[model samples]
Structure formats: structure tokens, C-alpha cells
Target: MPSDKFDVLVIGAGLAGLRCARVLAAAGRDVQVWEAADEVGGRIRTRAIDGFLCDRGFQVLNPAYPELKRAIDISDLRLQPFGAGVAVRRQSGSAVWVHPLREPARVPSMLAHGGVRPAGVLALLRWSLPALRPRALKSSQRQDRSLREGLDRQGVRGELRRVIDQFLAGVVLDDTGATSNAFALLLARVFLLGVPALPSDGMRSLPRQLAAPLGDRIVLQRSALHVESDADGWQVHSPDGVVHATHVVVATDPAAAAALTDVATPPAHGVVTDWWATDQMPPGPAMLWIDSRTDKPGPVINTAVISAAAPTYAPRGHHLIAATALLAPTATPPPEDATRQHAADILGADGRSWTLLTRDVIPEALPAQLPPLRVRQSVRLAAGLWCCGDHRDTASIQGALVSGRRTGEAILRSPARI
Candidate 1:
């Protein structure tokens, strides 16, 4: 069979692949993206189930991400912002803490919860404020430590520490608090500056928006099996046929990239998210509910009334609630019964009547964002081979886009292009 050819070929159609293709194509480089999935948006996909929009997993879009702003029209997404507060479930009940800057009127209500200590507040500020300035977070100036150690060193203990740890465990999918302190602080900076929101349709709209400009340059269901260096540049072997390209970008997930190239396998963090629909109007603002009990009640790290944040997610008269539990890559997903019970306990609601919409078991939800943070890993694999993805960056939508943009810039500057 004849081989198809292009100036550049990008594997995987996730955020990274799409962004890289955009940059290269914009530069007048003949580019084509081969995505393995039937549709685009790898992990950032959504499905309509019984009139409910269920994402591959629970995810939110932050408008503050620079790459996000550059990649799509935020206004077109019709963003639905979450309340800048969280409800912490305790032994007694729940306590809500809203950022005073965003919700000053809620200060009295927050103080009513009674866990905010002056010392903890000051320590938290001391630990996190520096992240606002990129120069302050230079890894060389300070040794990167685990979040637990950083919080302890900064004297962020007791209830404040518990709330932060539990809430972030859901965000990073690591309950051990072993995530890099620098990386965590950067994430905090992002939240501090902007509220996370969902698109009117769902998170899938993001990749779809990014892919719009590329037109038919993207060929779905074309999974690249083996990529080998050839005289012209590289040959990507797919079940359909062989495609030759002057440059190849392995923008797949960490595991797939490792399988296809010489890149080392990085540690992975997994998550199990269960979506349940209920006739009960979930009481409370559009905020995340975190289990902060000293003697934890369930496996769920966090629970939220997603419909409260994105009303379009559920059909009229029904609310959509999501509970997420951190699972090891090899561990069995928690049973639906346990997940439902844990969500109930955290939200202090009766979920007995709620219907389980979907349970997503993602063994590779994210590449572990460990300590000694290297924000920009090398994308070039060899003379003409390259790689880019969340695994190559900070393990977020922002990181993925940034890595892809960087890869495109690097390729444009390379002298090896055919």
C-alpha cells in the first residue's frame, strides 16, 4: 500500500496534540493530527446519559490559565463559575469558607464555621503568597518538598491543615500529601486568582473548540501503533496504513508515549468518579464538599453538586452529584454502594434514591506531579521525533497546552525539518 505523507504528524488528539497542531499549522507547516479515539478530547470527553451530561471524570475549567485563554473563546464556552468557597464536612456538620476577596459578605458566615485560626491564616499566607510571583517559586532558590512537609514547616496545622489536605487530595488525586509543594502553591495561586468553572455544554467543548480551526486536518480513529525513523523523517504504523512525516509529535498520555518511544514511564495518579442523579435539589452553593474528619468516614475525597455549578449538566428537576475517590493505578475501583454512601456522608444528604448515572474508572487520570518540579521537560526525543503532553508538563490543561505550544516552537526552530 502507498504511504500518506505530511510535513508534520501529531499522535493523540488531546489538548496537547491539538495545540501543537494549531501552532505548526498557523506557521504554514503542512500538519496532520492522527487521533486514535473515535472522537477527540481523550480524557476530556463527555456523554449524554438519560438527559445528564457526564464527563469522563469530574473536571473544571479555569479561565485564569493563560494557555486556556489563548486557545479558545471563553465567552463562547458560556462559562458557569463555581462559588469561590468549599464546604468542609466535620464531626458535627459542615463549614463553608469563601475567599473574602470574592465574597466579602460571606466572611461572617465563614467565621461562624469556627475553624479559621489567626495563626493558620498567617501561615497559609506565608506558604502560598509567594507563588503569586513566579520568581519567588524558582526551584533553584528553594529545595522542593512535599506539601505535607511544607505545610508543617509553615505551621499550617490542625483543622486548617486538614481542610487544605483533603480538598487538594481530590484536586491532585493524591491523599498522601506527597505532591510537590511548589506545584501545589502554583495551583493555589491559580485558584486564588480565578474561580474554576464548567462550560455550558461540558468540558469536552474545550478540545472541540481548539480543533475547530484545524478543520479536516484531524483524522480520527487513526491510531499510531509503531513510529520508526525513516529516510524522509518518520513512519507511523497504523492498522489502516503507514503515514510518513518529516516530523512526529508523540502527544499521547504518559503510558502510550512510553510504549511508543524511549521516554521513561512516569508515575501515574488514578481517580474513580461516580456521577449520581437525584430528584432532591442539592442544598448549598455551587461549591465542593470535602471530608475533613480526623477519623475519615468514607473513601470519597470530595463530593459536589455539579448541577449547581453547571445547570445544563442535568435535565430539568434533577440534580447531578459527583463523588471522586483517589485510586491506585492497580487498585479496584470502589463499589457503587460505597461511593454513594461516602458522598451522602460528606454532603449530609439522603442519596438512597439517587440513581447512579456513571462510574468512570480512569487508571491514568493524570501523570503524578511529584516534587523537584521541572515545569518544562524536553519534548524532543531524537533528531526528528518529539513528544508533548500533560505528562511532559504540570499535569493540567494549562500544562498540556503550554507543552504543545513549546513543542511547536521548538520544531519551527529546528534545522532538521524536511
Candidate 2:
């Protein structure tokens, strides 16, 4: 309710914004967060419907996410790992099974089943070599090649390219030609380091946990209109009112950030729709399914049934499956019936007995540009203005947290704060 007197004001209550507020508030700064949605957790959202816990998409946190380990109490949540293994069903009616690379014996079986192609295995080896580890870069010289270009340079071929492309589509929700190689490699490193796990409850709980300590410091259902700076400090204008603070952090998706400040460019992509089902599907390990040969230009990268790995997601004897597709710039949300049919067809669940439980189309969810590890400008663009988001670093939950923390640290180090 105050007009202009807080230490910091953060926009967008997504993981990035919440994390920023948490760190600043914990440090004894007067911090406040404004979320356009009635609730926190931006893209990381979950809903409970008809005895099923459904998420906006199939999202999981890698055990190796440094920001998660450092910023939140992982022990407080129930974590479920990927099922025994992952399987990829080809259009030719054959299936490929993929297991964690740590299990050498399983690797043979995976290769034999065509789970991974020979070229993919070789490319993985080449890319995974210690000598190829990512290095720090100056903002001006950071590489911006697409994932496709990176794979091609690594000599990925034939069946292996199809499999790898599909998997990347499912994970990144963008065509390889559109995704940044640097970002893809960063994600690969995270996956290679540990198993991916989901919270037993849902992904939204992660943000809720981060917002717990901030308590009443967070403001929900408030849309930030603009942010401006004067000689004294920064002002954040929201639909409810205006808040002037010593520092302002635009912790939103790239487009939203550009709208609020004078940023020259923002990531381009937007909106993602996901559908969830309960009960009636066959039993199997959770897998990321990439339909490479689909009639569509890009593959339909969706998580097949994951309830097996985390039964707590649904009631006993019920399974939870989710499929997500990115919306094109000119596209609108598909009709409910059409989306349902599309889910069944893509998931290969024609005769299965599953019931459609929840479907959500998040308009303007993810930014378009494949996120760049380093932004052209430092976190502090102005004396009292900062920016942070997945578009600045990695695109996963980990990136948001790390960016937020870095922004907080930058604010603390600034002479303006002192």
C-alpha cells in the first residue's frame, strides 16, 4: 500500500521474482513482489482436480541444480526419480529404450533396442568430453549457435539425429534450429550430472516454498505496467498503485522485462499449452517422447506417462500423463475437444481408458529467444535497476534461482545500497 519507500520492488512472482524477494528480505531489505496472477509460481504451476495433482507441464528438477540446493530445503518436499528407464516409440512401430548412462550394462541393451543410435552415442561421447566443458565468456563473444548447428558440428547423423532432435524438442519446447547450443549444452551438463526428479506434490510447490519466508512481503494479482528511474531511486508502477524503492528488479520473462524497462531486445517465444490425464493407460516407466516424423514441421516433444515414477501425483490405481506443445505466434488455444484428441493421438493412447483431467494453455509463458548464458548488459543496467530471468542464463528452474540470487548479490554490492 505504500507509494515509494521500500528497499527493493520485484515484478513477476515467478521463481525468479520470488527468489529475488526472498534473498533481499532475508538480508533485512524492505522487499515486495508483484505477481500478475492471483498466485505465485508463474510458469511453474500445478492444480488439483478430481483427486489428481496436475501440473501445467511435465516439469522436473535436476538433483544437481545448484540454485535449488542452495536456496531451498529440498528435504521438505517428496522427490520421485525417473522410472526404471525411458522409452522412445518410433513411427515404424519399434521402440528405443534409454537408461541413465551411469549404467554401462543397460547401455548395451539400450543400444540393442535402438533406444539410442550409434551416432548419438558417439556424439554424446564427443560432447561429454572434459575438454569441451563450457567456459566463461565475455558478453560480446558468447556463442549463439542453434542446437541443430551444434549437433551437426558434432557429427550427429541419421537415426541418431532424429532421436536427439526429438528429445531436445521435448525438453526445450523449441526446434533445434531455434535453441541456443550454449543453452542446450548447459542443460545437458545438468542432466549428465544427476537424475531428474519431480516433487511428489507438484512443481508449483517449489515456488511456494521459496515464497514462504517472504510471508506478506509478496503482492499477488498485480500487473506491473512500467518501471522508471529518477535522480533519487526507481519507481515500479502496477495496476494497484506505484511503489518507489531504492532498487527495482524486473524478474519476469524477457518480453515482460522489455515492456517494463528500456531494454532493447527480449526473447521472442511465447505461450505453451499442456494436457494431463488420469487413469487407464498401460504401465510403463516415465519417458520423454519425441515424435520426429510427425506431419508437423517440428516434433511433438511431450512427456509420456510419468505417474509410474511418482504415484503420489494421482490417486491409487490411477496414472498421470501430460503432453505439451508450444503455440506459434499467430496461434490461439486449440478447442478443448481437439486438444484432447490430439493428446491421445500423439501419446499413442487410442484405446486406453484414461480420463482427461486437466488442460491448461499458458499464453505468454516462455520467452522466444533460446536463452543466452550471458546478457549483453550486466545485471545492473542502471544505478537502481536490475534484471533477471531464465532468458539470461539456463531456462530451467535452476537458472531462474541463480539469476535472482546473482541480481540480489549485485544489488547488495552496489554503493547505492550502502
**TM-score of each candidate?**
0.97, 0.87
Error of 1 at 116 (Å): 1.1
Q: What lDDT score goes with residue 414 in model 1?
A: 80
- How far residue 395's Cα lies from its native spot in candidate 2, in Å, is 2.4
Question: Could you give candidate 2's per-residue lDDT for residues 1-418 as a string of tens digits?
Answer: 3545787888888888888788788777778888888899978888888777788766777777767899899988788887434455565544545556565677776777764667677886675453245564213234556677767888877666776676666567665467766766766677777777778888877999999888888888888787788656976776767767888888877767888777655545443454556557754446655564545323235556667667778888777776666666677755555545555665567624556676665555555445344533367777888888876656667778878888888877775542
Q: How far is 27's C-alpha from truth in model 1 (Å)?
A: 1.5
Least lDDT summed over 10 consecutive residues: which range in candidate 2? Answer: 131-140
Q: After superposition, how far is residue 249 of candidate 1 from its true place, in Å?
A: 0.4
Worst 10 residues of 1 by lDDT: 133-142
Per-candidate Cα lDDT values, in order, are 0.87, 0.69
lDDT, residue 8, model 1: 89
